[model samples]
Target: MSVIREGKVKRVLEDPESSQHVIIEFTNFVTAGDGAKKEELEGKGRLACDITEFLLQYLSDKGIETHYVETLEGPKIRCFRAAILPVEVVCRNVAAGSFCRRYGIDRGIELSEPLVEFFLKDDKLGDPLITEEAVMRLQLVNRSDIGFMKSIALSVNHYLSELFAQQNLRLVDFKLEFGRTADGRLVVADEISGDTMRIWNKEGESLDKDLFREDSGDLLSAYVGLLDILRKTDPKIIPIRSEEVHVMVMPKEGIKNPPGEVTRKGLIRLGFQDVKEVRVGKEFKIVLTRPLTSSLLKGLELMNIKLLTNPIAETHEVRLS
Candidate 1:
């Protein structure tokens, strides 16, 4: 097979049997922080290939066009040849990781609505988020193509979110890439596995690349576990509806509130001397696929006390909807 191209974690080769197809080989190579950190884990490539195959097949069965044709030998797959786009599409269901850092919001805050974003696929520039206008101006993709990608990305997010929720895992966020075939058809290309997505268990533990990025857990073992989950997950399973749990954090009555007092003074100084008081509080909304049982509420309350508030000076209220 003649080589078509090579990337950090995978290589593409021309398929001798069909000129319209290519063979993609996943490598053990992994990187994080824009390739500032790197490592090779044994069996990681095969695990990635299997995970991608499972997900892409699920998507294709859902009537989404993808480059995936069939799984070949270990760590390899045959796919239709397409000119991969130079844009990365990201869909976020919750506030976490770079989303929190970028927006200065606390992690774990469930979004009121899912968000889709675009980034230039240039590693040299840290793949900074790009606007649709910028994408058009840069000629990276046309306006219509942007709309198509955004729509498909959201659809993928919806399906993947339901799939993971069934397995009791939260699909926090993921990145996707699309390409155009010789017939000018837009199809999802590249891999979708632990490396391309962020998944968290019910306890908010990372099951994706964050373990490798943060150096806090075993990457290979996590990937293996993810593969097992995907292998058993039924793409045709009915989706479980998620319930919204809202948590409100506020200062305890009679507690000294220096920040609140400052805000009150500022509001009064601006004009209204009748400004009586000001209180600052935080609100968090968490979505759960499981029933809101007493035990679950206890766990959430414990989490609030341990991580969401100062027990001595703050109180929290939990409500379900």
Candidate 2:
């Protein structure tokens, strides 16, 4: 559990057996405006975990491949490892914050469509938002990737805006991080907690950011209230029942065969109270130039590799080969 990187409210660590990625540990200490100031709030981490877990499950169920993997040790959420992009996506549904201050827009005024903005990942530079041309000129990300990321971020805001409205909350604006997975899939990677979004109650009272910005003295209370609203809205929305399993494969000739040893550790590591273990085996690797889809069954049959396993009657299960 050695710390690999520490953020304002979370620390990331490499899983001992898996050198390819790390696990994030959300902390109770919250911060804004980079590391300018920090405050300790009791139960902040738990609330973040609970809320983020719910949103991640909901979004994933709706076909969003978020970085989330599972929750371990009750409150901690496990996620698939990724290489974070050096950009922060700020999706705004209304004019507020610096937008109102700098551009003289009225607060709470909704935009016709959600505006997707990008900020260079440098807090010391005051996180100035840049245009799409500047983003590509600076080479922060590939042009195509940036386009895809913006599309996904806007879609996420649309989905969340509606979801929060159901709970009588207005989704003003939020920040999101995207990362490339081991398989090169770009997915949302950061924790979507109260710290990252500006949520307002039906009465237009602030529920998230204002508590921190204005030092409202009821920061934790506001967070708990938001959680209470969520709980009442969907108490039965438990952690997702993961059906898909992932396995890391390498060339057998050059790499030392740790299949047996890795398999044992994986079994124990993945054996959560709710998860079940299935059989494991070895097979040759198949590389596809494009994305794999359900329509590619004929191509898969030609390859002669077992790609999937029979569904087990358990909450979760994994097989490594």
Candidate 3:
């Protein structure tokens, strides 16, 4: 595979046989604070691919234009050739992340409606915000392109916010990147995972990539939790089923204010200032009532999204023994 661009979490490679297509390979590599923090977390690639595939397909079904073709096995996907624009369209529904820090707004403050902003996608400059006029002035894209991007960004926030609300998650904010086709058509490109969006549960608890960015929980487990919630909305996400599958769900590390947290407070007051952090998660053993097979195992894995765990907040394992 000829390399096109290697990004923080994915690698883009030129498709050897097709001049008009490319292959995107997701990596388990995780980075935050713009490369200040990084890790090679196992299962990260598969989680990103699954979420991206589901969301891209969701947008396609909603009559939105996109470059998504289909997800292949593992962490790779195929797409039509297009040049990515060096701009990120951000949609915000709640006060959080850079929005709060930049404007000095309180975190979790709800916005009356969706808000759209533009940022130049330059890591060296820390992705500084740019005005629509700046975009046109720089000749990166014209005013028409900016309007189109904002329109679609808000549209996406509407669809996704409602979609997540059904699963009791609040869509706080998200980032989107677009690409222009050879024929001048702009379409949604790149992946949308927990890495790009900020999500909160119905109870106002952070559950998206913010967990990792804030050092409050395990990112891998949170990614798994999100995948679980999303898979419930799409039955076609996976098609494996048998009654004889066993699964185990557990909380990822770095969790804050777990059930164990309640116990630690009393200890601290008792002069045990040495008390450290307490993390807690759950474990469930699933037993099926049919013969075991690879297909069934896959089905059980898909079912995990429904209840076994939340891909946004937990990590799980599957085994027969």
Candidate 4:
């Protein structure tokens, strides 16, 4: 398809078959500090796309209108094309990030109620915070649209915060963009992923892009972890099965694994100095269509040894349940 717009981490392309939709192709580029820091991280695009698709669909199911249509191949998604508004709506629940910096307040302070803020979408001006009167004076969007966006933003925050809480994560803050379709219907646009929000685990540890921004941990690992958790929690994502195969692969004794070493050093850097060893491995859960038998169990274990793991460097265990 023909390219319509290209941003730091996404490309918008005209859909050949659908006049009402556009294809959003995600890229591997990750940025922080308002594009001051950037890196091309492999697999980041797919993770962001997957997370956004899940979240937008979740919101849509809860009666929120969004631009998401459906996921396409790889990191691309089909979405309704809309004239995106020049304003960004931010919803804050717990104090963190720029809020603390701007107001000189400590992080982790819970607000009695959700706070909605607006900012200009212009990158040149650092997206300066704009007042409600300024939004109307600038004519970015009419008063009615502003009011609707604010109301929708608060509603979205309520649902999203609860969803994250169910996953044992705190939605510290997030940004949302709205757009008007060709038919003049307003809907949520852009994306909702770790890139556009701050998520903290129960221990106040970040499971979002802040890991990459602060050089604290692995960004891809965090995204993958989040995806795994969500998948497990979403009952509709996986079908119920009578039995399944569980496989765990690990480095053989005395074998040198570079990832394990890297993880060890990373844990040490993160103040886990007491950690003596770290072994990075792989785990797989395969749903089965039939009952597990002795013959099939043996075959799976053999397959794991022959194909899934290196006999000389790694060992694997297969279990059926």
Task: Give the top-scoring candidate (lDDT).
Answer: 1
Q: Which stretches of candidate 1 lie over 4 Å from their true place?
A: 238-321
RMSD of each candidate relative to the true structure: 15.6, 17.2, 22.4, 23.5
lDDT of 2 by residue, 86-195 (tens): 89899998887888987887889988988888888887898888887888888888765675567567667766777777787889999999887887777788888788
Clashes of each: 0, 0, 12, 0
Q: Per-residue lDDT for 225-316 in model 3, tens only?
A: 88889877643332222222235665667555457787788788888998896555555565554333234445666878887788877777
Off-target runs (Cα >4 Å) in candidate 2 are 234-321
Candidate 1 accuracy as lDDT: 0.86
Best by TM-score: 1
* 21-40: candidate 4 lDDT, tens digit per residue: 99999999999888899999
Q: If ranked by lDDT, best first, what sequence of candidates would result?
A: 1, 4, 3, 2
Q: Whole-model Cα lDDT per candidate?
A: 0.86, 0.70, 0.78, 0.83
Kindly report the root-mean-square deviation of model 3 from the true structure over all alpha carbons.
22.4
Winner of 1 and 3 under TM-score? 1
TM-score of each: 0.73, 0.71, 0.72, 0.72
